[model samples]
Target: MTAPVTASRGRVPASATAGRGPLGGASLPTWLAAAAAGMCAAAGWLRVLPGTRMALLLALAATAPLLLAAASRLLRRTASTRDTRPDGGPRPPTAPPPAPAPVSRSVPASTPVLMPVPLTLGLSLAVAAPVAAAGFWGSPARFAQAAAAAVDGWAHLLATTVPAGPAPLLATGPFLLVWVAAAITGELLARTTRAAWAVVTPAAVVFAASCALAGGTAYAVTAAAAFTLGGVLLLRARARDLRGPVPVATRPARVARVARAGAAAVAALAVAAVVVPHLPARPRVDPRDHVTVPDTPLTGVNPLDRVSPWLSTPDTELFRVTGDGPLPQRLALVALDAYDGRTWTSTARYRPAGSGVPHAPSGGRRLTVEVTVAGLGGVALPAVERPVRLDGPATLAVDPDTGLLLDTGGLAPGLRYTMTSLLPAPPQPADVDAAPRDPAPATALPPGVPAEIDALARTAIGGETRPGAQARLLAAHLWARVRNDPGSAPGHGYGRLAAVAATGVGGAEQIAALYAVAARGLGLPVRLIVGFTVPEGANGLVRSGDVAVWPQVRLGGLGWVSFGPTAQAAPGWQAAPAPTAAPLPSTPPRVVPGAGVPTPGDRLASDGPLPVRRPDWPLIALIAAAVLATAWLSPRVGRAVRRRRRRSRPVPADRIAAAFQEVVDTAARAGSPVAASATVRQALDRVDTAIDRRRPPDNDFAPRQADLHVLRELTERAVYGARPLTTAEADDAWARADRLRRRLRRPAPLRRRRP
Candidate 1:
């Protein structure tokens, strides 16, 4: 009571389906299986995709199969309704058959015509849970944001930091194409083929690529294999339901086909396992390295070099800090002493400084500052004046002279560090004169110093002999003229001369650099300090706007003392008394020397020794050959082991079935007439006929043919005889079958055997 069979056709006709409802509608399980396959494939991509945008990827992947299924159903319905009569008129309709009488017994209520919404939602949630968990584990906040913008965040949230390469589209293009094809192809193939293996092909390919690209981790490979097995099981079950039952005569052939399919699948996985590990790992570039330069002149630590678009966003919290008492007005990032005419950077060597905390100055107090960084992104760790001790997960390196923190890594979000520093005392005239002798390197000027800069310095100092007096005069002069406006700042090409020519109209960076350069031009030691200024408010919310810069001049005994030269100079610096003549320089001031070389112990430590590598071609070849050989032979070995296991089973009929299957598979592989649709009797006859048809048959072929015929009879008896098959008889049949198989595989005689 089934639709007409098409010989050797693997699948049941659509009209003879078992699980379909009375109206021939698609079954719910079929739909769910397809959706699950798509969902698992999407989940597999989580291990390879770069960002916390799993919600969007999963939503797209899960819905694709459903959409394809709906489209397929619509196309089938349209095809069924179409009239195919050659004439321009519709064919005449036949009389309808009589309706069957209804039974009195109760039946289950019919499902609605529409797809089940709750079931679909439940399946989607099930698929989305693992992806969500993974995203949360990696980055909770970013994942939440991506989920919130699932409908429209693809462009902004789903991206890697790597730049577009030669084939930019290949990265995402192949993944999407494979996803859509898998959904549509799997749905169509499910109906045309008995097994759903074809439906999962695209998904398998994608999963393999993902594993290879993700460095072939054990977890990734295992997950992909498990999902593939699940898809195979689901497909096989649906195919079985559609096909109904297998006849006893054909069971042996079916088992052989299943074995072949399994071997093929195992071979594919073995090959992937052997090859994927040797593939190169993916490379990614950090987006933070490509900072743009500002259009206007810069001063403090070359502030324009660190300018970022994110910092310009209003109301964004940058960082937060807490200290024991009042915080210093400024927190230095680094001190720049080497000016390259165009920019200022640290070029001095650094030595290891101990972590032990240092005592505060005579009148200053010791306090600890805890900093919690937010949106800022840089390698520098900002701390109060003269950090003595740092405590954090990251290793800390400091410049002994400037006390600037060395670059460790990017300042990631949510980073917290504690710094213990000494509060620096306000600069005083007596303190400046009491400082030790200043180093000549601090006053060295770059080559080709413009006459305009020299004239401006000479005019600002006006014959002042004291170091502190000259510094104050130049600072006040620059502060009076600079407006801190971009339009009024000097343009590029002339260095500090341009700023002096423009009447010092620039921002903190330009003015600070102007003061440092002018002080150095007058044979005074000075350096630039770039840092953040603490506002009067105690909220402790530091925004990008709070960034500032100033100059620190070297004194006789007090060391380097800070002085603000911008229009926004702190009140303390402006109120400091002018330098006195008491502790004058050991010798009179000299003319500015050419830029001096940076001595050792000025910056961060040097890199360690690199490791050596030598490639061994012979060893590499041997390893590759071993992997390839194992992958190639694994399936055959597995098939042999399975056959041996079946032979040892207690059931006699199972042994007969396994032995007979081996004969049919071997004959088919040898290109003999052992058709899959043939019965056991027909297959035996075909084997005999094939032996006779061979030109000059082997001398032992006649005896092998007789043995094969006897074994076939035993197999038929075991399958259909009234009496049960005995263990002794099954063993005898197995022995004869193995002998005949070996003879059939033997080489034919070349001559008439010495006739």
Candidate 2:
């Protein structure tokens, strides 16, 4: 027969007769469930996806009722056992309770089977549909591309199977598989073992998904959803078991315990997912254009000579010059009198008839040239008729025969050379009357010369009296009228000089060649000066090797006079009288320099290489201080996190019972009837059951049997049992107890039915 229980002053008193059992010391699962739910909510606030949020909520909701029930049952069982004691003092230790009988098919059931299936399917569809739509409709190609790119990116991260398409799918597919598998596995484990598989299953799924989705889209959300769903199902199953035979009476306390554990697990997994994959050591980038410039000079290598059929046509720049002074008229380099299809050689070997010293005419002037030479292939420099001296560190030697500079080392930047050129007075008509006779080699023509040359020449010079006058008149007329269009057809090559003379229009090289041929035909000496022309403001003049082609006509007494028919030289020349004061001793042949020159210590005073400036120490100190401050704060944040986690841990079932008893004691002290020996779970369940029955369970003896059942199971499993309760089971028990407690505490008409 059951022993009779008593109450005192409308309050239930703590029992002293209860023996120590596993259930007596167990923590409630409710606190853990609540904690997990709270963590999920926080993750949602931090921008975790909706699917994840729903999954977590479902898990919490599904297991909450069960957890609360277990907590309530545990409290009741504890109180009843205590009340059976003979005295109020601590009871002697008793033998451990007998092992529960194996669950049989005959046992009555209260909950429905297969509750999670519908929910799981609905959630899966909801998550997948939108993703599918995005991939198929919004932009299939872009989706594919993004996926492919993401996969390729991750290929650098993980040793994964190569997918045919985008990379996101690789991670996404694996994530889905792992998540589903984990969920099923967790549910089965919970059903078979009554162990909380919620935390482990979800955590494992999340970890695997995170690894796959390190750089993938929606990874965090997917991982969270998978974990939450699996955990919730497992917890729900555990909660059901807790509510079955053994019941806890401390509903309120157990609820709190389950809530804390759930919250901690959720928070930890979320943080782990976010933090782990972001560690460095990412893939190396390979850019398309990554050619390294060669350090050695490129001489004798004509970049334009080998025209590869496989390569695109080359781009040729019509000379560019930069300098400080007004743009120049015409800057000549070398003269070419002979040409094959590929080469242009000078008429004959150069032979200097005079001393090596250049002789500028009486009206000569000094012009400083800072030439930056580039792209000259076997070509020679064509300076003014006479260049007195060159001043630059460049190792360019003068070819005495051709009066040109030769440097096999090839042209480079920052070349500075000073030249004193003879500024000859403009020629008068009488000067043209005495044209010079053709020189030996100048009169000889290349074999390919076109037949139309003689006729075209005769027609061009017919009106002029003298050969010199004729050549000048023709040159002047051609320059004014001929349009310089380099894009035109080759027009009979250099051999068709006569055809060019007739047309009176051609490219720069063509016109220059024609002039040479015409002048030669007229029995006058002329040379085809194939050299680059420089405009004023041209800087960095090194050796004369930089010039392109032009034409030069020999005057009877005066040497060759440079004339550019394609691009006329700058005008306005006033011949200066010979200097009376013996020209300032040639500037003592100073060691003028070009690029790559190392200035001596004394020369550092002049404009030398710029120095690398160092930053002020004060600024550096401030930056250092800021870094230190940040470092100092980081550990504080870490400590705060640890404290929060500790607080979030599942509350012990006894503590929950104590809290419930305290509430009851306070109420009892206020003149309400109370039982003489009662557990927290029993009081809470009695109160809820009494309300449900629409009748108070004798004031202090309020029935909370349902709640006690939940609490007792959670307490026994968590405290005395070796296996820890799962997040799902703890959550369910907590939720049920909370609802029952709230109802029991209600003022009036809304009381619930008692068991």
Against the true structure, what is each candidate's TM-score? 0.41, 0.30
The number of clashing residue pairs in each candidate reads 12, 139
lDDT of 2 at 637: 52
RMSD list, candidates in order: 17.7, 29.1
Query: What is candidate 2's lDDT per residue for 564-627, written digit by digit as tens?
Result: 4554211122112121211111111122222111111010000111122454456556555655
lDDT of 2 at 626: 53
What is the C-alpha local distance difference test score of each model?
A: 0.52, 0.40
- Where does candidate 1 stray beyond 4 Å? 1-35, 44-186, 194-197, 202-540, 543-654, 667-676, 682-697, 723-732, 743-755
Query: Which regions in candidate 2 have their CA more than 4 angstroms from the true location?
Result: 1-328, 339-344, 347-363, 374-385, 434-440, 446-449, 463-465, 480-482, 491-505, 536-548, 567-755
| lDDT per residue as tens, model 1, 662-732 | 66655554457343334566566665554444443467667776777777777766555556788987787
Candidate 1, residue 632: lDDT: 70
Instruction: Quote the positional error of residue 518 for candidate 1 in Å.
Output: 20
What local lDDT score does residue 705 receive in model 2, on the 0 to 100 scale? 55
